[model samples]
Target chain A: MNLIEILSYGFIQRALLAGTLIAVLCSVLGVFLVLRRLSLIGDGLAHVTFGSTAIALALQLYSAASLLVSLPVVLLASLGILKLTEKARLNGDAAIGIVSAVGISIGIMLASVGGGYNVDLLSYLFGNILSISYEEVIIAAGLFCVVMVLLWLFFHDLLAISFNEELARVSGVRTNLISAVLVMLTALSVVLAMKLVGIMLISSLLILPAVSALQLARSFRACIVLAALQGGCSVVAGIFVSFLTNLPTSAMIVMINLLFFCCSCGVRRLITIRNIG
Target chain B: MPVEIVATERLACGYREGYVLEDISFTVNAGDYVGIVGPNGSGKSTLVQALLGLVPISSGSARLFGSRCDNFSQWGRIGYLPQSLHLLNPIFPATVAETVALGLLSLKRFPRRLTRQDRETVETTLDVLGVYDIRSKLIGELSGGQQQRVLLARALVNDPELLILDEPTAALDPETRERFYHMIADVNRSRGVTVLLVTHDTGVIGQHASKMLYLDKRMLFYGGFDDFCHSPEMSSLFGEHSQHLMCHRH
Candidate 1:
């Protein structure tokens, strides 16, 4: 089939729909991750998921049923690390590094012990956008709805906690609950969106969109909205461009986000200078 | 009155260790202007934090409006403008309007998010501080003096009965600091808001504060400004060289 015909196929259409949903969700979360300076938490949790999938595969598991059974386990592990970081008052970058290294090592051990070299493992590591299935797409969509609803209901609380935790606590916000939920939301988002851009590039989609939105976004609410829009456009456009040139979708999406980040950085510098002048 | 506004007895205040300032007792009337002055490391800030429930009381009791300081849920009734209003990054995207609205987080008991009344109060406070023109401006873009005004407005937006300003004028130039002192006087006199101001500027306090609490590792004196300046303790605290700046208070 010709390139245009391939792109217009029903499977391609479904893939785009799913990718867009993932983009929307990741982008919304990316702003907070960047704002909270928890970009590495998302990256760390993605590594944790790798260990989870490795465990699932070593036991001969395939697909959603296995992911369902193991996701909680994976989430709990991330939560443990998050709690540890808070309790021990560790530097956030250090904590993410320790967790990432340990989890990836454990996953490598698991994969080697399984007596098989699976190419599917590599696919999940870096994403196989065209190879995304309908079931995972549905799961991603469901998760997107839940995350969005939670964000909506707790918008004020999230805003309070994100800006200043001590102030939020003094103002009677349940900062611990809200914070845990925020981290979990990041965990869930990384899982769903990692399928499109892989773990390494997922934060790019999340952080870049939010950074760009920061140029114009006044409030936390505006930041999230702008992030989602920037992410959605990047995904759709990236997918189209990648399709035309037969480039990797992950690389294309990340490149697009990087471009936006550079532009916003320049704009922010200009605005700051103008204000100073 | 029906409920005591603030009551503390033998209050020993500190962050987490033993104590910074020990054996303190005081009660403030609803509309009194109390200024705390001390040399560096005198536990002045720690004592204020204890009163604000941000620090642990190593011993004795601290209460706000008849409840323990920790349980004082009426956040709107007590406002605090910390020493460094610029503690937050300038790159942060909060505008003057939005920063002030944070004070409304305690206003969940009120019907609306931010009523027209709240907005007017904010504007009036900013105007009273003489920085109403910068209402739409990003807080990061403000001068140090302007930023303090914004922080002061945020503190007052909830219409608290008791305003606690910790060196609110510390970073301002002398003229700006003079203006802030005037604003504090206006808020206390016209609005009948009780004000507790903490500063190292003893001269300013002697001139303006109705009540002055002096400290050097401990409170050397606590009473009307007239009594504070005349005392030998005040003389000792200021030392012999500061003789001219501090005179017998009337």
Candidate 2:
């Protein structure tokens, strides 16, 4: 099919819009998470989403209804991760590891005991972005607004905590509350994004663009803008490229992000050499 | 009866590992320049953190501005510069101006957006600290001395009534360190900002501070520097020769 022919499909249009929106939220949040050394949080939460989705599937919840089960579970799981670090005195990675391990094991146990739901669960595991419904599109837009607006309102506080938690607390930034908000938002994003990038590849969407932007941006604002641009562009491009090449849409998006990251690294090296010269 | 800006009665604090501070009792009044001096592992940093409610008190009372430290909400009246400059991420991407602007955040409520007036305040603070010329430079790119000045400007930008610094000059050269002390003294003298400085530079801080608080996991001494010099307890603790050298240094 031609470019115009591919663009003509309603499902294709919905996929493109929702994918871009989800990608932007993940990328922007990823910047803060990466700086805080909580980048693995996306992956950890994605694993929890996987396990929760299995529960949802067993309960005969599918599509948007699945969110009814996964959303709250993942949100609580995110807080659990935070509490583990603070109260349990476990390091962030170790806490994430424990939560991630439990989540996946539960999912695996459900999948085996329940049997027959393998085909349905497989679609969620790998994603099926081209089949996105109109309601999912609207849900993606709402999620985008909610995350972005909260981020805007708490921008300086988030910046402060990400820079130095001790100093941010001294500034009366309400460090604990802000941290809870951050992780919960990440949980929400991870749950919504699983449809766009699949459970396994969701963390890549959160990490790659932010790391790429960090390589070259001179200011924090520029870093955020760069990460968002890369994220949105990767999604749009991946959709078209996958339609043309017959590759998996989610994998294509992640590959495009990797390509952008490589380009950023190269440009960074060139700028360094130019400055030296 | 000067107003009590900070009061801690028998305050103790610790981590899960063990207690770092104990039996710490002192009160700082308005406009007092108090130097908190201690040797390595002396819990000086922990004491300040406990006062700010960053570290939980194991027992005893810690209050700031008459409110319990745990309930103290008047952050706008206080500024703090922690000792962990090396702990800052090297590539944090915040400009000197942006970094200083964050100091004004303590004074703001929800939906805290910086106004044009706030920006001007940040600029004026940068100018006062002699960091105006490099306002646009990224913090990670600046030298240690420049970064220190930028951070100090951040601490002072809100025009806080009290400034708490923990080893604020650990990384500066001798000349820069001396200038930093004079600048702090100027703030205390001119603006009447209460000062609580933690440092190992007992001799230099003695020249600027009205009082001295010597700690070694406990309140070894808390009094006027003159009294500290004459106190038999300090003499026994430091040994007469070391005490004499510490007191006589200009």
Candidate 2 Cα errors over 4 Å, as ranges: B15-18
Q: Which residue segments of model 1 deviate by more than 4 Å?
A: A1-7, A216-221, A268-277, B1-3, B14-18, B109-131, B233-250
lDDT of each residue in B121-178, candidate 1, tens digit only: 7777778767788877777778888888888887787788888888788788999888
TM-score of each: 0.89, 0.97
What DockQ does candidate 2 have relative to the true complex? 0.75
Model 1 over residues A200-233: C-alpha lDDT tens digits? 6776777788778877766555667778887888
Tell me the whole-model lDDT of each prediction, alpha carbons only.
Answer: 0.76, 0.92
Docking outcome class, model 2: medium
TM-score of chain B of 2: 0.97
TM-score of 2: 0.97
iRMS value of model 1?
A: 3.3
Contacts from the true interface found in each model, as a fraction, amount to 0.20, 0.66
Question: By DockQ, who's the top model here?
Answer: 2
